[model samples]
Target: MPSLRNYDLFISHAWKYNEEYYALENLLSSADMFKYRNYSVPIHDPVIDPNTKVGQEKLADLIEAQIRPVQCVLVIAGMYAAHRFWIDKEVAIAQSYNKPIIGVIPKGQLRVPESVKFAAHEMVRWNTDSIISAIRSRAL
Candidate 1:
Protein backbone atom coordinates (compact mmCIF):
# COMPACT_ATOMS: atom_id res chain seq x y z
CA MET A 1 0.00 0.00 0.00
CA PRO A 2 1.23 3.48 -0.81
CA SER A 3 1.60 5.91 2.01
CA LEU A 4 -0.74 8.89 2.24
CA ARG A 5 2.30 11.12 2.58
CA ASN A 6 3.61 11.67 -0.90
CA TYR A 7 7.03 13.28 -1.05
CA ASP A 8 8.13 15.57 -3.86
CA LEU A 9 11.73 14.88 -4.83
CA PHE A 10 14.22 15.96 -7.44
CA ILE A 11 16.68 13.30 -8.51
CA SER A 12 19.78 14.81 -10.07
CA HIS A 13 21.10 13.41 -13.31
CA ALA A 14 23.05 14.31 -16.37
CA TRP A 15 21.24 14.99 -19.64
CA LYS A 16 20.89 11.24 -20.12
CA TYR A 17 19.08 8.99 -17.68
CA ASN A 18 21.15 5.99 -16.61
CA GLU A 19 20.65 2.57 -15.08
CA GLU A 20 21.13 3.88 -11.58
CA TYR A 21 18.29 6.32 -12.07
CA TYR A 22 15.93 3.59 -13.21
CA ALA A 23 17.04 1.34 -10.40
CA LEU A 24 16.32 4.02 -7.87
CA GLU A 25 12.89 4.57 -9.36
CA ASN A 26 12.11 0.90 -9.11
CA LEU A 27 13.33 0.77 -5.57
CA LEU A 28 11.15 3.66 -4.54
CA SER A 29 8.10 2.29 -6.29
CA SER A 30 8.46 -1.13 -4.74
CA ALA A 31 9.23 0.09 -1.27
CA ASP A 32 6.45 -0.59 1.21
CA MET A 33 4.39 2.45 2.21
CA PHE A 34 6.41 4.94 0.19
CA LYS A 35 5.00 7.40 -2.35
CA TYR A 36 6.78 10.19 -4.15
CA ARG A 37 6.57 12.45 -7.16
CA ASN A 38 9.71 12.82 -9.24
CA TYR A 39 10.70 16.26 -10.50
CA SER A 40 13.64 15.02 -12.57
CA VAL A 41 14.24 16.49 -16.02
CA PRO A 42 14.14 13.74 -18.58
CA ILE A 43 16.19 13.73 -21.78
CA HIS A 44 13.10 13.16 -23.93
CA ASP A 45 11.62 16.31 -22.43
CA PRO A 46 14.44 18.82 -22.11
CA VAL A 47 13.65 22.39 -21.14
CA ILE A 48 16.20 23.91 -23.55
CA ASP A 49 19.59 23.60 -25.09
CA PRO A 50 22.18 24.21 -22.39
CA ASN A 51 24.96 25.06 -24.83
CA THR A 52 24.38 28.78 -25.16
CA LYS A 53 24.67 31.21 -22.25
CA VAL A 54 21.03 32.25 -22.58
CA GLY A 55 19.91 28.67 -22.80
CA GLN A 56 22.06 27.74 -19.83
CA GLU A 57 20.42 30.42 -17.75
CA LYS A 58 16.99 29.27 -18.84
CA LEU A 59 17.78 25.68 -18.03
CA ALA A 60 19.16 26.71 -14.68
CA ASP A 61 15.97 28.57 -13.98
CA LEU A 62 13.92 25.55 -14.95
CA ILE A 63 16.02 23.29 -12.75
CA GLU A 64 15.66 25.69 -9.86
CA ALA A 65 11.92 25.79 -10.35
CA GLN A 66 11.83 22.00 -10.20
CA ILE A 67 13.84 21.94 -7.03
CA ARG A 68 11.96 24.72 -5.27
CA PRO A 69 8.80 22.74 -4.57
CA VAL A 70 10.54 19.49 -3.67
CA GLN A 71 11.00 18.27 -0.13
CA CYS A 72 14.48 16.95 -0.91
CA VAL A 73 16.97 16.22 -3.67
CA LEU A 74 18.36 12.73 -4.35
CA VAL A 75 21.80 12.58 -5.91
CA ILE A 76 23.26 9.41 -7.45
CA ALA A 77 26.79 9.59 -6.20
CA GLY A 78 28.17 7.35 -8.94
CA MET A 79 26.80 9.58 -11.66
CA TYR A 80 28.39 12.75 -10.34
CA ALA A 81 31.86 12.09 -11.74
CA ALA A 82 30.57 11.98 -15.29
CA HIS A 83 28.04 14.80 -14.97
CA ARG A 84 29.55 17.11 -12.43
CA PHE A 85 28.69 20.26 -14.36
CA TRP A 86 24.92 20.01 -14.27
CA ILE A 87 24.77 18.00 -11.05
CA ASP A 88 26.86 20.66 -9.34
CA LYS A 89 24.44 23.33 -10.51
CA GLU A 90 21.48 21.29 -9.28
CA VAL A 91 23.11 20.85 -5.88
CA ALA A 92 23.77 24.56 -5.70
CA ILE A 93 20.15 25.34 -6.50
CA ALA A 94 18.89 22.89 -3.87
CA GLN A 95 21.21 24.39 -1.28
CA SER A 96 20.24 27.97 -2.12
CA TYR A 97 16.59 27.10 -1.60
CA ASN A 98 17.30 25.34 1.73
CA LYS A 99 16.16 21.98 0.38
CA PRO A 100 17.67 18.95 2.04
CA ILE A 101 19.80 16.69 -0.17
CA ILE A 102 20.09 12.93 0.27
CA GLY A 103 23.15 11.44 -1.36
CA VAL A 104 22.46 7.88 -2.45
CA ILE A 105 25.51 5.69 -2.76
CA PRO A 106 25.00 3.54 -5.80
CA LYS A 107 24.59 -0.20 -5.36
CA GLY A 108 27.99 -1.94 -5.13
CA GLN A 109 29.75 1.41 -4.93
CA LEU A 110 32.55 1.57 -2.39
CA ARG A 111 33.74 5.13 -2.69
CA VAL A 112 31.58 8.21 -3.05
CA PRO A 113 33.17 11.49 -4.07
CA GLU A 114 33.93 14.02 -1.38
CA SER A 115 31.95 16.70 -3.21
CA VAL A 116 28.78 14.62 -3.04
CA LYS A 117 29.34 13.86 0.63
CA PHE A 118 29.97 17.48 1.45
CA ALA A 119 26.80 18.67 -0.28
CA ALA A 120 24.52 16.00 1.18
CA HIS A 121 22.62 16.54 4.41
CA GLU A 122 22.43 12.78 4.85
CA MET A 123 24.11 9.87 3.09
CA VAL A 124 22.10 6.72 2.50
CA ARG A 125 22.74 3.30 1.07
CA TRP A 126 21.08 1.93 -2.06
CA ASN A 127 18.56 -0.01 0.01
CA THR A 128 14.97 1.22 -0.07
CA ASP A 129 14.57 1.23 3.69
CA SER A 130 17.69 3.27 4.25
CA ILE A 131 16.87 5.70 1.50
CA ILE A 132 13.29 6.15 2.68
CA SER A 133 14.40 6.61 6.25
CA ALA A 134 16.90 9.28 5.26
CA ILE A 135 14.32 11.11 3.18
CA ARG A 136 11.79 11.05 5.99
CA SER A 137 14.30 12.20 8.55
CA ARG A 138 16.27 14.81 6.59
CA ALA A 139 13.34 16.42 4.81
CA LEU A 140 11.83 17.29 8.17
Candidate 2:
Protein backbone atom coordinates (compact mmCIF):
# COMPACT_ATOMS: atom_id res chain seq x y z
CA MET A 1 0.00 0.00 0.00
CA PRO A 2 1.19 3.50 -0.75
CA SER A 3 1.38 5.91 2.11
CA LEU A 4 -0.57 9.17 1.88
CA ARG A 5 2.73 11.02 1.90
CA ASN A 6 3.50 9.45 -1.43
CA TYR A 7 0.76 11.46 -3.12
CA ASP A 8 1.37 14.99 -4.27
CA LEU A 9 -1.36 16.88 -6.12
CA PHE A 10 -1.78 19.95 -8.27
CA ILE A 11 -5.27 21.38 -7.94
CA SER A 12 -6.73 23.40 -10.85
CA HIS A 13 -9.52 25.77 -9.91
CA ALA A 14 -11.15 28.97 -11.09
CA TRP A 15 -10.67 32.02 -8.94
CA LYS A 16 -14.30 33.03 -9.21
CA TYR A 17 -15.48 29.66 -7.88
CA ASN A 18 -13.02 29.10 -5.10
CA GLU A 19 -15.47 27.68 -2.61
CA GLU A 20 -15.10 24.18 -4.00
CA TYR A 21 -11.37 24.47 -4.06
CA TYR A 22 -11.18 25.61 -0.47
CA ALA A 23 -13.66 22.98 0.60
CA LEU A 24 -11.63 20.25 -1.06
CA GLU A 25 -8.49 21.51 0.59
CA ASN A 26 -10.20 21.56 3.93
CA LEU A 27 -11.53 18.09 3.49
CA LEU A 28 -8.14 16.69 2.59
CA SER A 29 -6.41 18.40 5.48
CA SER A 30 -9.04 18.21 8.19
CA ALA A 31 -10.73 14.89 7.68
CA ASP A 32 -9.71 12.25 10.21
CA MET A 33 -9.24 9.60 7.54
CA PHE A 34 -6.81 11.88 5.74
CA LYS A 35 -5.12 13.26 8.84
CA TYR A 36 -1.91 11.46 8.08
CA ARG A 37 -1.93 12.36 4.40
CA ASN A 38 0.57 14.88 3.20
CA TYR A 39 -1.21 15.99 0.02
CA SER A 40 -0.34 19.62 -0.69
CA VAL A 41 -0.06 22.39 -3.26
CA PRO A 42 2.98 24.44 -3.98
CA ILE A 43 3.56 27.49 -1.79
CA HIS A 44 3.33 29.81 -4.76
CA ASP A 45 0.73 28.00 -6.78
CA PRO A 46 -0.16 30.03 -9.88
CA VAL A 47 -3.33 28.22 -10.84
CA ILE A 48 -5.43 30.68 -8.89
CA ASP A 49 -4.57 33.58 -11.11
CA PRO A 50 -7.11 33.63 -13.88
CA ASN A 51 -6.27 36.99 -15.35
CA THR A 52 -2.61 36.64 -16.09
CA LYS A 53 -1.43 38.17 -19.34
CA VAL A 54 1.50 35.82 -19.74
CA GLY A 55 2.03 34.27 -23.12
CA GLN A 56 0.52 30.85 -23.70
CA GLU A 57 3.84 29.05 -23.91
CA LYS A 58 5.23 30.76 -20.84
CA LEU A 59 2.09 29.99 -18.86
CA ALA A 60 2.23 26.37 -19.90
CA ASP A 61 5.86 26.12 -18.90
CA LEU A 62 5.11 27.51 -15.46
CA ILE A 63 2.10 25.29 -15.00
CA GLU A 64 4.12 22.31 -16.21
CA ALA A 65 6.71 22.95 -13.57
CA GLN A 66 4.04 22.68 -10.92
CA ILE A 67 2.44 19.59 -12.39
CA ARG A 68 5.63 17.65 -13.17
CA PRO A 69 6.51 16.84 -9.58
CA VAL A 70 3.00 15.87 -8.52
CA GLN A 71 1.49 12.43 -8.89
CA CYS A 72 -1.79 13.82 -10.19
CA VAL A 73 -3.83 16.91 -11.05
CA LEU A 74 -7.16 17.56 -9.31
CA VAL A 75 -9.63 19.61 -11.34
CA ILE A 76 -12.80 20.93 -9.74
CA ALA A 77 -15.64 19.84 -11.99
CA GLY A 78 -17.71 22.97 -11.88
CA MET A 79 -19.49 24.54 -14.84
CA TYR A 80 -17.20 27.52 -14.80
CA ALA A 81 -14.15 25.37 -15.31
CA ALA A 82 -15.21 24.71 -18.84
CA HIS A 83 -15.05 28.40 -19.69
CA ARG A 84 -11.75 29.18 -18.09
CA PHE A 85 -8.99 29.02 -20.69
CA TRP A 86 -6.38 28.63 -17.98
CA ILE A 87 -8.10 25.57 -16.58
CA ASP A 88 -8.13 24.05 -20.03
CA LYS A 89 -4.47 24.84 -20.39
CA GLU A 90 -3.74 23.33 -17.02
CA VAL A 91 -5.48 20.12 -18.01
CA ALA A 92 -3.58 20.04 -21.26
CA ILE A 93 -0.29 20.50 -19.46
CA ALA A 94 -1.14 17.73 -17.04
CA GLN A 95 -1.90 15.45 -19.96
CA SER A 96 1.31 16.41 -21.70
CA TYR A 97 3.24 15.42 -18.62
CA ASN A 98 1.44 12.07 -18.39
CA LYS A 99 -0.01 12.85 -14.99
CA PRO A 100 -3.32 11.43 -13.90
CA ILE A 101 -6.16 13.96 -13.88
CA ILE A 102 -8.76 13.49 -11.17
CA GLY A 103 -12.04 15.35 -11.53
CA VAL A 104 -13.74 16.16 -8.24
CA ILE A 105 -17.42 17.03 -8.35
CA PRO A 106 -18.25 19.46 -5.60
CA LYS A 107 -20.99 18.63 -3.14
CA GLY A 108 -24.48 19.57 -4.38
CA GLN A 109 -23.28 19.94 -7.93
CA LEU A 110 -25.16 17.77 -10.41
CA ARG A 111 -23.56 18.97 -13.61
CA VAL A 112 -19.89 19.29 -14.48
CA PRO A 113 -18.11 20.82 -17.40
CA GLU A 114 -17.60 18.63 -20.47
CA SER A 115 -13.95 19.52 -20.61
CA VAL A 116 -13.45 18.26 -17.09
CA LYS A 117 -15.13 14.99 -17.84
CA PHE A 118 -13.14 14.52 -21.02
CA ALA A 119 -9.84 15.38 -19.38
CA ALA A 120 -10.28 13.36 -16.22
CA HIS A 121 -8.78 9.94 -15.96
CA GLU A 122 -11.12 9.30 -13.03
CA MET A 123 -13.95 11.12 -11.33
CA VAL A 124 -14.86 11.05 -7.66
CA ARG A 125 -17.52 12.62 -5.49
CA TRP A 126 -16.77 15.17 -2.79
CA ASN A 127 -15.81 12.66 -0.16
CA THR A 128 -12.52 11.96 1.50
CA ASP A 129 -12.45 8.26 0.79
CA SER A 130 -13.33 8.63 -2.85
CA ILE A 131 -10.87 11.42 -3.44
CA ILE A 132 -8.06 9.63 -1.68
CA SER A 133 -8.82 6.42 -3.47
CA ALA A 134 -8.77 8.12 -6.84
CA ILE A 135 -5.51 9.84 -6.05
CA ARG A 136 -3.85 6.67 -4.82
CA SER A 137 -5.25 4.33 -7.40
CA ARG A 138 -5.10 6.43 -10.53
CA ALA A 139 -2.16 8.75 -10.03
CA LEU A 140 0.99 8.17 -11.98
Candidate 3:
Protein backbone atom coordinates (compact mmCIF):
# COMPACT_ATOMS: atom_id res chain seq x y z
CA MET A 1 0.00 0.00 0.00
CA PRO A 2 1.14 3.55 -0.75
CA SER A 3 1.03 6.41 1.68
CA LEU A 4 -1.31 9.13 0.48
CA ARG A 5 0.08 12.55 -0.39
CA ASN A 6 -1.09 15.70 -2.08
CA TYR A 7 1.20 17.67 -4.38
CA ASP A 8 0.73 19.48 -7.66
CA LEU A 9 4.27 19.29 -8.98
CA PHE A 10 7.52 17.34 -9.01
CA ILE A 11 10.91 18.89 -9.59
CA SER A 12 13.32 16.65 -11.52
CA HIS A 13 16.79 17.36 -12.80
CA ALA A 14 20.28 15.99 -13.08
CA TRP A 15 22.33 16.44 -9.94
CA LYS A 16 25.17 17.60 -12.15
CA TYR A 17 23.03 20.55 -13.03
CA ASN A 18 23.40 21.99 -9.56
CA GLU A 19 23.04 25.65 -10.45
CA GLU A 20 19.84 25.10 -12.36
CA TYR A 21 18.52 22.93 -9.59
CA TYR A 22 18.91 25.62 -6.93
CA ALA A 23 17.59 28.37 -9.19
CA LEU A 24 14.44 26.50 -10.08
CA GLU A 25 13.82 25.27 -6.58
CA ASN A 26 14.18 28.83 -5.37
CA LEU A 27 11.50 29.88 -7.80
CA LEU A 28 9.10 27.27 -6.52
CA SER A 29 9.82 28.17 -2.93
CA SER A 30 7.72 31.29 -3.09
CA ALA A 31 4.69 29.58 -4.50
CA ASP A 32 1.64 29.24 -2.32
CA MET A 33 1.43 25.60 -3.35
CA PHE A 34 4.84 25.06 -1.83
CA LYS A 35 3.74 26.54 1.45
CA TYR A 36 0.47 24.64 1.30
CA ARG A 37 2.22 21.32 0.70
CA ASN A 38 1.18 21.09 -2.92
CA TYR A 39 4.60 20.51 -4.43
CA SER A 40 7.45 18.04 -4.02
CA VAL A 41 11.01 17.39 -4.98
CA PRO A 42 11.78 13.84 -6.14
CA ILE A 43 14.40 12.09 -4.09
CA HIS A 44 17.19 10.53 -6.11
CA ASP A 45 18.04 6.93 -5.44
CA PRO A 46 21.64 6.17 -4.58
CA VAL A 47 23.92 5.62 -7.55
CA ILE A 48 24.95 2.09 -8.27
CA ASP A 49 27.76 0.82 -10.47
CA PRO A 50 26.92 1.22 -14.14
CA ASN A 51 27.90 -2.36 -14.86
CA THR A 52 25.22 -3.71 -12.55
CA LYS A 53 22.20 -4.15 -14.81
CA VAL A 54 19.95 -5.42 -12.04
CA GLY A 55 20.81 -2.46 -9.86
CA GLN A 56 20.02 -0.10 -12.69
CA GLU A 57 16.62 -1.66 -13.15
CA LYS A 58 15.92 -1.52 -9.44
CA LEU A 59 16.88 2.13 -9.33
CA ALA A 60 14.57 2.90 -12.18
CA ASP A 61 11.73 1.11 -10.44
CA LEU A 62 12.36 3.12 -7.29
CA ILE A 63 12.24 6.43 -9.14
CA GLU A 64 9.09 5.47 -11.02
CA ALA A 65 7.29 4.67 -7.81
CA GLN A 66 8.40 7.94 -6.22
CA ILE A 67 7.23 10.04 -9.16
CA ARG A 68 3.94 8.38 -10.07
CA PRO A 69 1.73 10.52 -7.90
CA VAL A 70 3.08 13.85 -9.12
CA GLN A 71 0.69 15.90 -11.20
CA CYS A 72 3.49 17.54 -13.19
CA VAL A 73 7.20 17.06 -13.75
CA LEU A 74 9.24 20.27 -13.85
CA VAL A 75 12.71 19.96 -15.34
CA ILE A 76 15.51 22.45 -14.93
CA ALA A 77 17.33 22.25 -18.24
CA GLY A 78 21.04 22.66 -18.00
CA MET A 79 23.90 21.70 -20.30
CA TYR A 80 24.59 18.12 -19.28
CA ALA A 81 21.44 16.06 -19.17
CA ALA A 82 22.27 13.96 -22.23
CA HIS A 83 25.24 12.55 -20.37
CA ARG A 84 23.23 11.81 -17.23
CA PHE A 85 21.46 8.46 -17.19
CA TRP A 86 19.17 9.13 -14.26
CA ILE A 87 17.88 12.41 -15.62
CA ASP A 88 17.14 10.81 -18.94
CA LYS A 89 15.38 7.92 -17.27
CA GLU A 90 13.27 10.18 -15.10
CA VAL A 91 12.23 12.33 -18.06
CA ALA A 92 11.36 9.24 -20.10
CA ILE A 93 9.15 7.83 -17.38
CA ALA A 94 7.40 11.14 -16.83
CA GLN A 95 6.81 11.56 -20.53
CA SER A 96 5.54 8.00 -20.89
CA TYR A 97 2.96 8.67 -18.21
CA ASN A 98 1.76 11.79 -20.06
CA LYS A 99 2.67 13.88 -17.07
CA PRO A 100 2.86 17.58 -17.83
CA ILE A 101 6.53 18.46 -18.16
CA ILE A 102 8.17 21.88 -18.27
CA GLY A 103 11.75 22.97 -18.59
CA VAL A 104 13.18 26.28 -17.44
CA ILE A 105 16.54 27.20 -18.88
CA PRO A 106 18.90 28.82 -16.46
CA LYS A 107 20.29 32.29 -17.12
CA GLY A 108 23.47 33.01 -19.09
CA GLN A 109 24.77 30.99 -22.02
CA LEU A 110 24.16 27.53 -20.65
CA ARG A 111 22.85 25.38 -23.45
CA VAL A 112 19.63 23.52 -23.00
CA PRO A 113 20.30 19.83 -22.55
CA GLU A 114 19.03 17.78 -25.47
CA SER A 115 17.36 15.32 -23.17
CA VAL A 116 15.55 18.10 -21.36
CA LYS A 117 14.35 19.73 -24.58
CA PHE A 118 13.30 16.37 -25.92
CA ALA A 119 11.17 15.67 -22.89
CA ALA A 120 9.78 19.15 -22.39
CA HIS A 121 6.13 19.76 -23.18
CA GLU A 122 6.73 23.45 -22.58
CA MET A 123 9.92 25.47 -22.30
CA VAL A 124 10.85 28.85 -20.93
CA ARG A 125 13.88 31.11 -20.91
CA TRP A 126 14.18 32.01 -17.29
CA ASN A 127 14.94 35.49 -16.15
CA THR A 128 15.37 35.30 -12.38
CA ASP A 129 12.33 37.30 -11.46
CA SER A 130 10.17 35.71 -14.11
CA ILE A 131 11.01 32.28 -12.81
CA ILE A 132 9.86 33.33 -9.38
CA SER A 133 6.80 34.96 -10.81
CA ALA A 134 5.88 31.96 -12.89
CA ILE A 135 5.94 29.76 -9.87
CA ARG A 136 4.32 32.17 -7.49
CA SER A 137 1.63 33.07 -9.96
CA ARG A 138 1.25 29.47 -11.14
CA ALA A 139 1.50 30.81 -14.67
CA LEU A 140 3.81 28.22 -16.16
- The prediction achieving the highest TM-score against the true structure is 1
lDDT, candidate 1, 1-140, per-residue tens: 54378999998877554778888888998987888999986564454778879888988888998999999999989945444788889999999999999999998889997878999999998988899999988874
lDDT of 3 by residue, 9-38 (tens): 667765445666766666665544343232
Clashing pairs in 2: none
- Ranking the candidates on lDDT from highest down gives 1, 2, 3
Encode model 2's per-residue lDDT on 1-140: one tens digit a residue: 66545467888866567777778887877755443322333344465343565555665676777778888899989889878987898898889889899999988989989999998999899889899888778867
As a whole number from 0 to 100, the lDDT of residue 101 in candidate 3 is 75
Model 2, stretches more than 4 Å misplaced?
1-4, 33-58
Say which prediction, candidate 1 or candidate 2, comes out ahead on lDDT: 1
In candidate 3 the C-alpha lDDT for residue 87 amounts to 79
Error of 3 at 8 (Å): 2.6
Best by lDDT: 1
